[model samples]
Target chain A: MSVITREEVAHLARLSRLALADEELDHFAAQLDQIVGAVARVAEVATADIPPSSHALPLENVFRPDEVRPSLTPDQALSGAPAVEDDRFRVPRILGEEA
Target chain B: MSLIHESAAELGRLMAAGEVSAVEVAQAHLDRIAEVEPKVHAFLHVDPEAVLVQARAVDERRAAGEELGPLAGVPIAHKDVFTTVDMPTTAGSKILEGWRPPYDATVTRRLREAGLVILGKTNLDEFAMGSSTENSAYGPTHNPWDLSRIPGGSSGGASASVAAYQAPLSTGTDTGGSIRQPAAVTGIVGMKPTYGGSSRYGLIAFASSLDTPGPFARTVLDAALLHEAFSGHDPMDSTSIAKPVPPVVEAARQADVAGLRVGVVKEFGGEGYQPGVLARFREAVDLLESLGAKVVEVSCPSFEYALPAYYLIAPSECSSNLARFDAMRYGLRVGDDGTRSAEEVMALTRAAGFGPEVKRRIMLGTYALSSGYYDAYYGSAQKVRTLIARDFDAAFHQVDVLVSPTTPTTAFPIGERADDPMAMYLADLCTIPSNLAGNAAISVPCGLADEDGLPVGLQIMAPVLGDDRCYRVGAAVEKAFESRWGGPLLKEAPAL
Candidate 1:
């Protein structure tokens, strides 16, 4: 059985917000199947007792005083926005068709 | 006697002594970039006027008797992936094209504070995902030695800028082998600081766990100096190491490995390895033994699984980290016509803005993290990661440092493996183990391979927080090789 099928790739593209074309779906399905096949060998590495490492190094939460410090001004903050309106980022409507 | 060929150390010294001015040094490099960039294509952006403004400021500070950093007036290249408030901070993708960042990356701010002239941003694989720069939405950066070949990526331009002598120092982010592999192919020096050793604040994320900002230079000592000036505890980065930076500069100057134990990784050599690359790596090991270092072959069986594990782990992190690029806030956005909803716009924007490789990773990561298959894919890969780290722990117990061929082969011709993702991934086979373990590793030019007559790299790795060890061993190998070749290996590269 193939690791990933064409329909699954389309499903993944939707989940990933990619909107891949018909050709991309076909090409990627084939390639991803091969990649997943090769990488699946890791599933066979059964060190049942060993723990999984979520990070390269152990991490901890950082704490800071509840005080404000100087940071980027609103103009600087909005400088790179694709679209801005009234000191805020402009965007398309949020509600989908059902709403 | 142009100033472009002078090392960063030499340039800084001359600028400090008042024997030379920063503008003069910057102009020489800018002139060289103009001359060679047409062929090398090492920089994605260069503004001579802005470059001069920074250079002139350095000279003014010196005139005021201000004590500047060691590399205060030296010119350096900034990788485009780092957010630079003054220049476009594209991660080699159209999504971020023409996007001037609101803040500088910690690395960029450090470079500016140190008075290093920012010539411009260098190119990389889009989001630092690929082994070669062909994935760059902008055109690929060509190898200086052989224009027909790649310069090792996603720091390809970072390595090429220094190799082509356009700049003596450049910054790079190593997610896998981006820095070391490029340095190996270009006949230069590159170092990946232990994860969390360098601040990543303002760096555009790519596999946040594995992405590490490091240095690329023509010499080991120069790399260490740059490493120190920027690396230390950063309150902004929760993961940044709170401990003092390692004594890398001191180690580079030590340049002696007498009585030090060196382990040659047994798994890195053999079938699928190029014969000439193996031969050069063998010579480097023998040279270490001749210098009174105790040499032994060490086996790390888990390293065999590093590639697949890294492919899954990196893509998984990338998928999560890159979610910020939705069409709502910053960067490229498309199909925002009022009739369409935000979700539709986001899908259209991502599809139009991202290159194929980035898209591939995003999808792969989505699949890996999705339900049902999560345990079989992402879960298994995490387990493999633990095993890889354990192998490093065991090897470090027996050896002070580990060594291997930086890459499987020399720089292959451009477009040779472009269509085959697996073939391209093989280029980073020897370098991924260190990234997985978050250990300090450095790659320095060993010698040219006989087959392709291209430069080969000797990779030296040390334990976490033991970054200085890699530089110590690297400096020793560099000194001996320079003495044997009568100069650095880059001196043998054909003129552009």
Candidate 2:
């Protein structure tokens, strides 16, 4: 069985928001399939009992006093924005036609 | 004075003693960059005026009697991945081509506070996803050793800057051998400090858990000095460890491996390793024994799967981390001419912006983490992470540190592995295990490979906070090899 098919790669591209070209779809399908086949070997050694390790160090929620501190000015915050209006980031419409 | 050739420590001392002004030292390096940058293409951005400005400030501070750090007046190259408020901070991705960040990364801030002159931002593999810098959207940085070969990467430019004498020191981040592999092929010292030992506050994330900023220098003590300057806890990054920076500089100065138990990873060498790389690695191990260190071979069976597990884990994290570049905020936005929706523009921009390798990994992570295959791919890879850590724990129980060839081969021809992802991935084989376990590892130039006449590196790995052990062992190897060869291995590099 193929690890990932061409159609599946197209679906993944959509899910990942990458508008790949037709040739890129074909190229990536073959490469991703090969990589998947090689990397799937981890399952062989990962017995059911072994707990997964998401990160190497322990992660904990940190807290600080609610006092405010100095921060980037509005000009600095929006400096890198592609578009800005009213000192905020501007983006294309987010809603659907119905909304 | 040969300012460009002097180590960071020497540069600092000379400036402190008023023997050399920071501007003069900076000018020498700027001149060197002008002479070499055209051939090597190590830097993504270099403003000679800006460097001299920073250098002059350092000189003035010293004149005012401020007690600056040991590396106070040294010139250092910053990796492009770190955000710099004053300069364009593109992570070698066209998506961020001309973007200027609003604030500095903690590493960048620390470098400035320490008075290290910012030489410029160096090139890297785009979003730090590739083993060789060929994936850099700008262009590949050619190796100084051979213009036809890769300099090793994602931190290729960092290693090459020091290797080519463009800069005495540079900074790099190692997620999976980005620092060590490049340093290995380039004949320099690169250390990946323990995962949280260095701050990740404003480092553009690749794999948040794995990305670690570290120092690259021509000598072990120089690397140690840079390491201590930028490392320690940062509250901004929750993952940052709250502890004193390890005594790595002192360990490098100590340079003793007497009675230390060194373990040669049994699974790393042979079969797939290049003959010359393996030969130099063995000689370094033997030299360690000769220096009064006890050497033994230890088995880490799970290490065989580190590369595969790493492929899955890093990409999975990258998929999440890179999601922040959705074409809405800072960076190259496209297709938003009122007709297309934000979603369409994001898709169009990402496709137009990311290189083939970055796109491939994002899609691979999407596939790995998708509903049906999650257990088989990403989940299993996480399990293997535990197994690999267990392997390290077992080995550490028997040895003070582990040693291996930093990589499987020397600098390969640039185009050789560009089309072959697996072949390119093999370049990071031996250095990935340490990343997976969140341990400290350093790559010090051992010698040149006989076959290709290119540099090779011996990797030294220690447990989580035992960052000092890597410096101790690396410094010993550096001292021994320097004496045996009558100079550093980099001295053997053909002059550009």
Maximum-DockQ candidate = 2
Task: Give lDDT tens digits, candidate 1, residues A1-99.
Answer: 887899999999999998888999999998898888888888888467879998889988889998999998999988888899999999998877788
Clash tally, candidates in order: 0, 0
lDDT measured at residue B146 in model 2 versus the true structure, 0 to 100: 96
List clashing residue pairs in candidate 2: none
Model 2: per-residue lDDT, tens digit, B5-51?
Answer: 78899988999889999999999999999998999999999999999
For model 1, the DockQ equals: 0.82
Fnat of each prediction, in sequence: 0.77, 0.81
Backbone clash total, candidate 1: 0
lDDT of 1 by residue, B1-496 (tens): 5688888888899988888999999999999999999999988899999999999999999999998999998999999999998898899999998999988889999999999999999999999888779999999999999999999999999999999999999999998999999999999999999999999998899988898999999999999999998899999898999999999999999999999999999999999889999999999999999999999999999999999998899999998898899977789999987899889999999999999888888888899999998888899999999999999999999999999999999998999988788889999999998889999999999999998899999999999999999999999999999999999999999999
Pairs that clash in candidate 1: none
Worst 10 residues of 1 chain B by lDDT: B1-10
* All models, RMSD in angstroms: 0.9, 0.8
lDDT of 1: 0.93
